[model samples]
Target: MQERGALLEVVVLHPRDVPGADEGGADRLFLVNDIESGGLSPEPGTVSRLCRETEIPVRVMLRLNDGLTTTGGELSRLVGLAEDYLSVGAEGLAFGFLDSDLEIDVEVCGYLADRLPGVPWTFHRAIDSALETDRAWRQVRHLPGVDAVLSAGSVRGLDAGCDELVERAAADPEVARLLMAGGGLRGEHVPWLARAGVRQFHVGSTVRPGGSWTKAYVDAAHVRSWRMLVDDAVDHELARRTTPYT
Candidate 1:
């Protein structure tokens, strides 16, 4: 099981946004490019700079395109990019794959994991888009180096997936430990998820002014508020769990 304190991971599109996220108590930074395309792999130089400069862990995205399926040629490029990110000291990676049948692509995922041995990675939100949720979860459970799975419990994001997330976490201990509740996550969702035993959370545009991904940058105060909110919720949940029933 994950440790008791809740973790706040923030998405960073550019180097400038790094300070606010780090200073705001973000536990990690999900580095990606082109947020409008659901996040593509960022330039290696950017990863190098951020990883070199920041104390916080940065998990670089390992996707070349918008879709989950990768071509052989794209896979080669991705492997090369993964090497570059690792050479620059990226703490970890965020990636996922799907077959044409819309199922989790274990072969592809395992291949990449083999090439990037010992690197901790996240199975990104592709699980929410899989044809069968149970099958998807089963496929990812044993994948090497996958320490976390980012999901909203649905492709449409938290408003549509919050109940499922809470229920699934409550039902499965492993799910609760590995799930990083995110994607359209809001302040209101934190307590419910915490009570359900989810210890990690992700935020993107929500930490930006007006929740705008393109117009504004992540504000430290906004990220700090989320940090405080998640910490408080987790503390309450921990207290409730430990207190003897009267």
Candidate 2:
């Protein structure tokens, strides 16, 4: 990854959205077959197809099911899926699991990290479920293989918690290394989020046409609009950062 302030354009794409995302100029892709349950592991063929089809990088979700917490068996399955995804040429992996007390399951996450040291890893929003989020996020930030955090701050969603997330990022340059702002982001939110030190923005259901609530389909135009909005936001943020203060 680049330094704390570099822009990373990432979009969560269902298998159905590949063509649209590709045509619409996405910089990278987070491929998930099951978007309704937050996100989950995708089919091996799906990963392979995306890797084969898209020149941009691809990352796959590793959660076997929806809930943030996982059993030992379920974690193993996640590991298995991670391995499968990497084998099929996924550029990175995104996932997280918590223990009963809702803290980062260090043992589990560490094991996954150790299992795939060469590839990049992102601790997903499941970190929001951490019982004491501040401590949990701090703990995970120091882990050996964690690269980025897909977070909406500590609260349930981005709108309410983004300022807190910005505070956390400003407090810790390490967290800023890959602090990706996501969760219910629309085009208008990009400029503000960019100003708050969010270097990456993750868009999911809203990127579809007909809107996420109306069972929107994959429309390249939707992705194109998002691309334009995000680019404008990043450019403005960069200019603001470099401007001389009189």
Steric clashes per prediction: 0, 0
Which regions of candidate 2 are displaced past 4 Å? 1-14, 213-215
Which lDDT tens digits does candidate 2 get at residues 25-119? 77678887667778778788778877877777888888887788777798788778888888888888988888888899888888888888877
Indicate which candidate wins on lDDT: 1
Alpha-carbon local distance difference test for all models: 0.93, 0.76
Output the lDDT of residue 43, model 2.
Answer: 82
Compose the digit string of candidate 1's lDDT tens values, residues 1-246. Answer: 435799999999878888889879999999999888889999999998888768899999999989989999999999999999989988999999999999999999999999999999999999999999998998998999998999999989999999999999999989998999999999899999999999999999989999888888889999999999999999999988888988
Scored by lDDT, model 2 comes in at 0.76
The candidate scoring highest on TM-score is 1
In model 1, which regions exceed 4 Å deviation? none
